[model samples]
Target: MSQMQQITAQGRQIEQDSFAIIDHEIERDHGGHSFSPEQWAVVRRAIHTSGDFEFAKLFHFSDGAVERGIEAIRNGAKIISDVNMIVTGLAPRRMQPFGVEAHCLISDPEVIAEATEQGSTRAKVAMQYAARLGWLDGGIIAIGNAPTALYEAMSLCQQGKINPALIIGLPVGFVKADESKRDLMATQLPYIACDGRKGGSPLVVAALHALMVEAAK
Candidate 1:
């Protein structure tokens, strides 16, 4: 059999082994946070996907996050991200069940022009333009690369320029990553974030994919 076939065939066994390790070896911290049943499913899946034990401790979900994300999926909310890598990682097979599409407009010429004219980064400019789109009124926004992108999304939401169903802000960097997440946490909006600079496109995609999996269920 082919290598791909072999891997596919062992999928169940792999999952079993992973779960065994998590259940038998890993332990939650003393007086640490815990998640709801649905939220726990996402966290478990993320740990399996990334092979990162820290995931369980890193993920922070605002109250009612799972329910809100599921409702948005059922309502056919679109997903937008700051970078193309995020859109690429979110496979169509997983997103099709919800009848939604993933979008990344960071490289659009208009966005570039707006950024140059406004003296802002393309990532921020993209968000500024996207905030005017009617579809994002209740869509999901994911930011995994640039901190400015996350800040723009939050600003748009706070100003009533756009209202997203949920925002997954986990951009990775030393500059403003931690501060952006802190700002997100301070907001009244529903959000899921990795609380420090230890985040990136892959982590953001994982969180989103986990939510989509739960929504499908």
Candidate 2:
């Protein structure tokens, strides 16, 4: 076979093997859980991405969150991320079928100026920017790198400024990361979050891909 075919084959094999390991370990270690098959798919992807079985315990999904996420993706809802990492991590091939696109305003000139002027983090300012642009409505807000962004997104949702279909609040940090996720859970909005600070862009990407896969099915 050609070199390109060899590489593709290797990649596919690696993913399959990794998932097999994840499934075996989860079944052995975590015998039972409240997550449904669809919810377990998202948690399993997160474990595959992080190599941490702890994700199965840490992850929390509001009622019907997985269903809401899949419905939104099927309807071509926009995905708004806190940082560029999530935008970069998301697979275009997976999203393209639904005409879905991921966006991040953290590096925008306007967000920079406003954040600097208001003495706020770029992540927080980016959420405000998204609310102003009306992109938060019927969209998925994926925050995985900055806790401040998660906090701001929660505030916007509570204040009736934005109505995102689902919020993936898994920002990783030493400051307010756990607190922010707890705050997200307190609200009535549909959300998927890691209960502590053990989250990152990879988890957000994995969660979105899980939803996309479900939507496709």
Candidate 3:
């Protein structure tokens, strides 16, 4: 347990001489530090002015996560593994079910391209497929190193078209992570984020499952 908890459970002890000195110091300590009335009024007004919001139900997108999580949300599922299929016509496993009901954000459509295709041409072809379909309701762009993705997310929010319930910036490699994390926190939305790293597809998959379990209720 913590030191404060231990002290709370067991009374503090001190030598008699030291106790008198400490007691005087304690007595001089500020006891009534508080917000000013005007400050409190402003806080109250801000709370009152905030508006209502819709729940995302459950949401997630990963460059290479299992599509089982796709069914977690109402209409969305998971991106199709085959780029040519996506580019030509086939929908992602999770798209049709949740597409209209959710807004899906893809952070590094580039990443998907890199992993799923041979070169930029194929990737761009795949991207056009995604672009044409666009973000389903609860989807979000999730690049941890890129500020542009965060800006895209914010722009969507500002438009009042798509608001994400979860933004998971679980990017890989030796990239810096603080900026994306800060951006996620600033969104005031439900967020499950990872830092500069890799090698935890299971954890990412599990987080989506957890969101599904919670959102089910």
- In lDDT terms, how accurate is model 3? 0.36
C-alpha lDDT score of every prediction, in listed order = 0.82, 0.92, 0.36
Q: Tell me the TM-score of model 2.
A: 0.94
Ordered from best to worst lDDT, the candidate numbers read 2, 1, 3
TM-score, one value per model: 0.89, 0.94, 0.36
Per-residue CA lDDT of model 1 for 41-154, tens digit only, reads 667766777777787788888888778887888777988899999999987877888898888989999999889999999999888878766656888888988999999899
Candidate closer to the true structure by lDDT (higher is better), 1 or 2: 2
Q: Which candidate ranks first by TM-score, i.e. highest?
A: 2
RMSD from true fold, candidate 3:
17.0
Off by over 4 Å in 1: 1-9, 28-33
- Candidate 2's C-alpha runs over 4 A off are 1-6
TM-score for candidate 1: 0.89
In model 1, the number of clashes is: 0
**Model 1 / residue 16 / CA error / Å:** 5.1
Which one is best on lDDT?
Answer: 2
Worst 10 residues of 3 by lDDT: 49-58
Of the two candidates 1 and 2, the one with more favorable TM-score, higher being better, is: 2
| Model 1 worst lDDT run, 10 consecutive residues | 24-33
Candidate 3 lands at a TM-score of 0.36
